[model samples]
Target chain A: MPLLKTENVTHFFGGLKAVSDFNLRIEPGELVGLIGPNGAGKTTVFNLVTGAYRATEGRIIFDDQDIVGLPPHQINKMGISRTFQTIRLWNEMTVLDNIKVAQHGHIQYDLKDIFLQLPRYRNQEQAIEAQAMKMLKLFNLADHAQQPARNLPYGQQRRVEIVRALAANPKLLLLDEPAAGMNPQEIEELMVFIQRIRSELGVTIWLIEHQMRLVMNICERITVLDFGETIAEGGPDDIQRNTKVIEAYLGVEDEEIS
Target chain B: MAGRSGNLFSSIFRPVGRIVSPVWTALRRQLAQTPVLAFQLGVLVAVLLEQWQGEAFADLLGFRRIPRFFGIVDIFEPFSDLDFSGILAPFFPSPNNISASPLQDSVQALGELATTFVKAFFYQGPRAPGFFDVTFRVLIYDIVVFVVPILIIAFLLRPLVSELLRRFPKWSLILVHLIILAAIVLLWGDDGGTRELVLIFMGINIILTVSLNLVNGYMGEFSVGHAAFMAVGAYVSSVMTMWAFVDDRVFGAPALDPSWGLPVGFAIALFAGGIAAAIAALLVAFPSFRTRGDYLAIVTLAVNFIVQSAINNMEGIGGARGLNGVPLWSDLSWVLLTTILSVFIIHSLVNSTFGKGIIAIREDEIASELMGVNTKRIKLVTFLVSSFFAGVAGGLFAHVLAYINPGNFGILKSTEVLVMVYLGGMGSISGSIIAAIIFTLLLEALRPLAILKWVVIPLILIVLMLFRPQGLFGFREIELNWGWQKAKEKPEVSGATAED
Candidate 1:
């Protein structure tokens, strides 16, 4: 059974329908790709699914529970987490702190425990720190644990964002242009990392990617969008051969990128 | 190598300076100490002299009890009783009385000294005979007999207890707190009398500073309407107490009419204050929860003004004329207990997961929420908790002053509380304590400056904010422990785990 599913989901901002009747589904442990041109409502779909914005009209179900009106954090607590396309991080906080913040949901310390600094507070903090460190080490970011999030290089910053989101221990991970600013070599490595996270960590990957090569390389199945509407969806070979996907990519009537 | 230069210089000068250095150094040391010593001595002497001679002058002027300062005494009568022989005696320096009746002279001198003290204080100025005199008397009754002593004890107890807390951890700390509470209750009683009033003000100030720092300093929310919430609490608790006192009796008048009604009133006052402030917080939180940085600040300021104006026009709660006769319930002990309690509560809150949520909100609200923190709930909880404490403080304030005017609960009071928080340090509980103590003292010290006090206050604030905006302690508390030892202990992973 699918872990998270969006059915006929659509979102409108003023006069523009940002995403229209966008339908997607992911079984547990399945790695899927969401590829589209600029302003194609890819992030908008992710946001709508995550309840960052109300869907103009649609239903989003996470683990068979209707998550349409739930708050973002509630959506997260329901086991769905995501990273921003522009790398939204707690800039002033240390890398470890950023990850630890995400771990707040799972903390065992209640208000009483914290206020009194009871044994529970002590145990919870220690446990969370270890977990956060392990998450950091997964991304090879243990060395930069004490450093501020903003101080890291572009690639490492992206890695930190992924690590922070993953620290929440969500079953579903949404990436919004994770390789947006990376060079070709960086993108190639990111492909492997994404696959490892899916296969080894066992998290379902739902990503919106502008880079065609990365999308074509790793995605088992691809959903293509254009002008807020789904123009194509299928295996890599089907998307490569589809005439409609070619027309959506190139402005011309019948054209495609090599 | 660094110390060797100092040693080399000192060794060379040691022999040569030994002969003349002692005398020269003594002279220079005396010269150096002169200005500081002189300034302090001058101020003390002036105050004591003013207290004495002013009464003497009043007596000579044939005034009975020079208004507020001296009691009814005729200073001029003594002078008038002196004969020409006695007048000459002052100049001649009597040899016989100096030795034989020296004891008798000392007794006469003691009477003269008392007369001098009363007279000096009396002639300084004539305050209003009725309301003014009563107010002055009340102020004196509270400050001199109560606030001063508690302040002295707090000054002595703070370091001693902090040292004990550092050494013994929790149990000893609790014992010290119990002792303080016991002492406070013993000295001031729990009644809403004059002693209670002073203690409550001191206590509330402490609470507001520490609790507010959790929001303004630790959570980093700029809240200016603290007094409005306080007013809410004061009105609520006062109304409830008044209701309980009056309604339970015939025709809604106090039945048994216990003198301790003020303390009872204050208990309800805190409850009412907390509830009302928490309710009021919802308005500001919903609209501004999604927005951070400057936007959230603007919303809180607006909420503050809204609450102030609402209270100003609120007829049921007294409106502009303000509520009267709150049945003076607080004393120094009650205030001290609550103050210590407030500090402990805030200290624990800031160190908890809930506190971490608050700090996360301050650090980055969006990031906090996105990480599955119920941001709205957290903000609401924080506001509610903060306002509840403010209400308790307000209840204490109303009963202590035995009156409540809208003007008293105005923005200025809020700013004063805010200053205490800022002066103490934003996230530092210890800083709040230090700031409250210093701020209260500074206020007393600058009282003589009158109208110029505000000008000096702002200037001092500007200087402090410029140099130490994070406050004296920043987010860290004034822990008495040696860091080296705590550091040596296998990193308290439990404490670290709690942060997450």
Candidate 2:
């Protein structure tokens, strides 16, 4: 069975359908890309799967559990974590604290243990801190761990978001516009970073991006969405050549898509 | 019979309701938009109405009379009869006895002034027995009364509560609550005096400051109407206790006597107050979903006014005249227990995973929700818990004073709590506690200043705000650790650069 599956998921905000009949199936440890023009509902799909938005009509099954109508925190606890399209690091918190907060769902100490600073609380906190530092080190953010996240440069903030997401030890990680504001060099670095996270952590990755170069270079499978509907789904090369995908992006003959 | 009575009630009020509904709605809308202005307007209207109509207006509303504010002299009454000159005679050698020169006399006078100021700062009034006057047996009695319960609660009962919390979770809070209540009753017996009253007030203030800090500081939501919750708690609990214990009350004969059932009645009253406050908070919480920061501040401020007005108009509970005959069940033991419990609950809550979620919402609501933190629920829960404790503080306040008035919980009361929360540094529990103690002490210490006391306090506050706006602790949390243990551990690093 697939590790994650979404069947006939549809969502509407008033009269406008944000996402309609969105179907997805991902095998374990697969790195996939969701590509679309602005307002193509790429991020909406991530939202639905992560339980940030409940599917108006469909099933979101993660690890054999139907996650429909579950709260986002519970969904995260179920081993699904996602980064935001806009970098959403806790600006006032230290880089380490931002990552430690993401690991909140997995912290195994009760209130009593924490209040008394029991061995269980101490050990778990230390372990989580150690794990966060390791991820920070991987992203070259170890030195910056003590600094407030907002103090970091834009590119480093994006990296910290990914590190925070990974800190949750999610089986399936979702990245929403990770390269939104990065320079070309940073984008290249992000591609390698994405690949390294997948290979080293053995986590399934799904990323939504407007950067075609990063998507085309790294994604094994690519799904194209347009006007709240999936237009094409195949390998990256097939998606690049598909007429429907081309039409969705560039528009057919002189007829504007919008 | 009930249906007929209800119908009759509606029929009698229906026409009046129709006439007043539109005006009330318009007033409410105006109040919602600019609550501070509405509050000022209400005060102005009240003052104008009082001047224009005088006793007639008050009589029509069932307001017997406005109670006099407790004067500074009234507060220092206990100390007035005592001869403090005797205590200070040895500290400052008499110029007459020493045959001192003019300069030496002046220096001796200065020394006497310093000693007097120190005494005033530490004074608990002369009514309470002095430390030296109490016999060794009484000392042992005091120690046993205070320490035995604390030791039992902390050592024996705490582990059980902790275990229960881990296993049952929901039951643990109740278990802890019962333990504290039992300990309070057992320890306090029937002790009642000015020192106990002051300590109880301090405890309640600490609870208020810490709880308000939860909403205003940790959540980064500006809530300046915390006293409204306290008012709700005070009124509900006061009414509950009055009904349960006090005879010949508005609600008729007493349901329970003050003798054996007083403790139980007080406990129930405290719980009722907390629940009532939580319910009141819900009324504000729904609006808070769409509003925040300055808007939320206005909403809370309006809530404070609404609650005070509602209470003032409630003639059954004494209206503007204030409720009296509330049994004095709150002692230092009860206050101390509740304060400790409040601190423990709030501290544990903020440090837990749930606490991280709350902090996350404060940082970025949309981002927290997107990250799966359930921002709305976290916010609601935080508000409810904060208000619940505020109500608890109010209940304690009511019991300690044995009387309550709507005027007692005005905008000024809320602002006092806000000051403590901010002075302590929002989000810092220990900071709130320290600030609350200092603030309370400062208020008491300035008692000798009379009306000028207010000026001195505000001036000090202004200086503090100007210098340390982030508060005494800022955003730094004091983590509970076995001192230096955390600092000793070093992070293991592999030799690899970012390029590698």
Candidate 3:
């Protein structure tokens, strides 16, 4: 069975249909890329899947459970976590605490334990700290752990956001424009980082990006969206060659040469 | 049946084993780090034991009563005993006996007035060298009666209660409540008039400071209408108490006699007042939270005005005339009990995951919600709880003063609370507590200055703001380290550029 399946998901923001008849099925550990133009509802799809917005019509099944209408936090706790298109790090919090805060869902100690700082609270905190540090180290952001997130440079801040999402221990990771403001060198590094998270952590990856080069180079499969509808879905080479996908990214001709 | 019974026994023993070993380990670690705390604990335990054993320890030590300091009475006794008439006779012409003119009589009267003023403000009285001996004695006596108990109780009981908290935390709160109740009884039963009143006010201010800090500091919401909640509590509780206990002279027929049902009735009134304020908070908070920062502040300020005006117009509760004849059911004990309870609840809430959510909302609501923190519910709950405690403080205020008025809960009152919260440093419970005590004491001390008190207070605040804008404690919390609770260790992030 697929780890996540969304069938016929539709969403309307007032009268405007942001996403229509969207469908997705992802097996465990698959790296899927969602590429689209600016208003193609790529981020909206991630929002719908993560329960940030309830679809006007459809079902979202995750880990064999219907997750529709669940709150974003609950959806996240149920093993789907996402990063924002813009960096949304808890800016005032230390880099380490940003990661620790995301691990709130998995923390099992009762209020009594936490308030009193019981052995359980200590043990759990230690575990969470160790895990967060490991993730930070993995992302090469370990040196900036004590610094406030707002103090970090833009590229590192993006890395910290990804590490924070990973700290939630999600089964599926959603990256919205992870390569948005990065230089080519940083973008290349991010590609390797995404691949390593998939291979090493065994987490399924669903990324939304406008960087066509990065998407085509790294994604195993690509889904192209335009005008709130999926125009094409195939291997990167097939998606690149498809006329419809090409027309969505470029422009449509007045007369098509058959 | 035998197997089931064995399993039950093991289940109980398993937890007990886990609890005892860790507690023992923590205790050992605590003792190693802070041996003074252990010593203080020992002294407190000994005092408790002595009390339980019917003062055998005190009797053996030849102590008949707990030592006391030289009070106002002791300082004034010599002055009162002095024949002031004889001393002032040479300074003033005799008006009555010598049958002087109107001018001489007026001059004699003026001289008397000057002497009285001088005596009252500057001089307590002429004192012998023996007075110095008594002063030293009183200072030593004060250490035993006041200072030692506080030190022992604060240091020793905190850990013990916290340890008990790990097992039965709710019950531990009751233990704290009972201790505060006992302290109240002990202090109120003393005949130190103005000092006791000041202490009671301190308790009320602590409640205001801690509760307001919940919304303003922790939740990062600006609520300038805290006094409105207090007014709601004061009016509701005062009305309830007056209706139930006061005779026909005040308002309506008494539903409950003051002698028998006053405590129960007063308690119900206070709880009702808290609930009423909480309900009011719910109405304001639901809509106000939609707006952020200054807009939210303006909404709260408007609510404050509304509450004040509403109270002002209500004729039955005395309207602009203000309500009176509220039974003095609130004592130092009640104030102390409520203060302790409020602090415990707030402290526990802040330490919980729920508290983390509130703090997260304060930091960044959008980010907190995206992280799955249910920010709306957290914000609502925090507002309600904070307002509820403010109402409780209001109820205490009503009974303590034995009067209620819309003027008592004005914008100025809210500002007073804000000052305390800021002065103590936001997001710091102990800081709020210290700030409250100091604020209350400072206000009381400046009483003689009259209108100038306001000028001096603002000047002090201005200086405080200029130097320490974050307030005294800033973002730092005073978590009593019991060794088991490890301090948050920040890993030094290497100062490398992201390009590297």
Candidate 4:
């Protein structure tokens, strides 16, 4: 069965149609890529699916449940979680605290338990903290567990965002420009981490990347868009040779790298 | 010689302090490094000793005693005297009717005319009908008569509830709270005597501070116009109570017997006050829908002025003089109980899902909404709930003062509430409670300081804001577990290392 599906989803910003009739489907545990130029509605599609913004038209369904017009948290609770293109980590909190906050939905502790420090509250808090540390260790960030998210380098912050999203234990993960400003070494490491997460956690990933090489390297299948309309969708080799995909990426003409 | 004697004693004690150095060190270190549980017990013991010692000293000094001692010298008696005739005599000069000759009478007449004009424009004359008269009139209403009986019954019912709480092991700690509050109120009672109205005003201030904290602190918003909402409540309750006591178009007929108007009036007034506050909240909610943060604060402040000016323009409600005949509904018992109840309700709300939503909003609005929280609805609900409590406080205030004017609910009043909230800490429930008690006590304690007291208040606030901005307890509550307690045995952690 298709895990996450958007049917004819359209989003408009007055004179411009940011995302129009954009549709995609991913089976359970499949990894997909969305790539386009700077103004292409790749992030807009993510926003629509997450309920950050209402789609101008159409429907978003996840795990057989219609999720259109639902709030982001509700969508999150429905087993779909996401990372921001610009990495919106809770800047003031510790890395562990950031992860802990995302786990607020899963934690069963109430105000009574929190204020009185009831045994249940204490046990749950301990368990969550332990889980958060484990998630950090997976990303080689256990050493920076106590450090604030803002103090970390951009690459590290990006990883923290991914960690927080995973803390929700969602079945589907959406990554918006996860490799926006990474050095090649960091990108290679991120690629490996993504693959490991997919293999071990058995979750589907839909990633939007601006770097062609990284998208070509990691994405099994690519969906290409230009000016709110999908132009092509296929394997990496097909996308590389597809005339429209090349045209969308290289301004109507391929400029050879010297 | 006295200085040397003191030094000699200290010097001798120094060795004693040092000779048992290891033992003292061990004791000091133990105290310094005690677990939270041990520290809590020590604090409880210290608090009890301090309270006992304080009462003993007051008794020795001929101050009013506490815990069933209602002697003539009881600290709060003078505050309940219900008289202010003495203070008004000086500001309001009388007309000189007699003169030696016709020409002299004419000259004196001119001066008298000038005095009359000045008094008319600026001063509230001594003989002019004021709060006392209105209070007396309201008291004659049946509503006024109904209040005391109800209060007595309510007070009687309290011990039963407390007993229930005691039986439940979870609420045993709440008993500690009653003791603490009693200690505070008794300790801070006015010995020098203040006007009954002023005392009532102080009580209302406590109500406003604590109730508003539920919004600004726990829910996380900055409210600048709590005073406006109080005024709205005051007007509503006062008008309704007035109608019940006397014939008015608003109520169609008198709702209570003139003989018992005060009691009846007070009850009606409380209900009206709540409705008025809710209506005002509706006005506030519209602006809040689009504008947030500082904008919301500015909107509330404007609402205060709007209510005040609206009251001023409405001639039927006495214009600026304000609608009178509000029965004196608030006594020490009433004020004390209301304060306690407000604290309890707000504390519980902060701990509930509704309260957690408020906290979540305060923590991060976008995140809260993204988590499926209806941010606008929650804000509105809290705003209205807060207004309801503010109304209850206003009704109590109006009855206690006997008379109120539009000027009573102004920016200055808002500032006072703000000061209490800030002094208590923005989000700390227990902090607000302590701050209210301390703030009231400080105002009384520094009465001799007069204008100098305000300068000191600001300095203290500045220091506190700088050093402890999150407030005394942050968002933590003052839980009174009255009877709900647990087995004293500590749970052993076998494997975990000490956090320190």
Best by lDDT: 3
lDDT of 2 at B477: 69
Clashes of each: 36, 0, 4, 36
Q: Assign candidate 2 its CAPRI class.
A: acceptable
Binned by DockQ into CAPRI classes (incorrect, acceptable, medium, high), candidate 3 is acceptable
Best to worst by lDDT, what's the order?
3, 2, 1, 4
Q: DockQ of all candidates, in order? A: 0.23, 0.24, 0.25, 0.15
Q: Could you give the C-alpha RMSD of every candidate to the true structure, in order shown?
A: 14.7, 21.1, 14.0, 12.8
Runs in model 3 lying further than 4 Å from the true structure: A1-28, A37-41, A48-79, A94-160, A166-171, A180-193, A199-202, A210-214, A226-231, A241-258, B1-191, B245-248, B251-254, B257-265, B479-500
Model 4: how far residue B298 lies from native, Å: 3.2
Query: What tens digits encode model 1's per-residue C-alpha lDDT throughout B1-500?
Result: 12334888877777776877788877555444332222222333333443556456445434443422122112122222212233234444666654454456556666765564454444424531332343445454335433444344444444454454456655554564467445434433344443344345556788877767777887787877788778777777777666555443212666445554556555555667677766776666777767656786677666667777787898877778877766655667667767776777777776555566777787777667777888887777777778778877887777677668778777788889889988887777888878876786566545444555677789999998898877777766664432123431232222132111
Model 1 spans > 4 angstroms off: A106-130, A137-148, A151-153, A183-192, A211-213, A236-258, B1-202, B218-221, B240-269, B280-324, B422-433, B465-500
Looking at candidate 4 chain A, the ten consecutive residues that score lowest on lDDT are A249-258
Give the candidates in order of TM-score, highest first.
Answer: 3, 1, 2, 4
lDDT of 4: 0.69
Model 2, residue B373: displacement in angstroms? 1.6
**Fnat: each model in turn:** 0.45, 0.37, 0.37, 0.13
Each prediction's TM-score against the native? Answer: 0.68, 0.65, 0.68, 0.64
Tell me the tens digit of each residue's lDDT in model 3 across A1-258. Answer: 999998999999999999999888999989999988889999899988888888899898999999989888888888998899999887777788888878877777765675466888778878888888888877778888888899998988988888888888999999999999888998898888888888889999999987877898888888898978999998999998999987887786674321
What is the Cα-based lDDT of residue A181 in candidate 4?
88
lDDT of 4 at A8: 95
Which one wins by DockQ: 2 or 3? 3
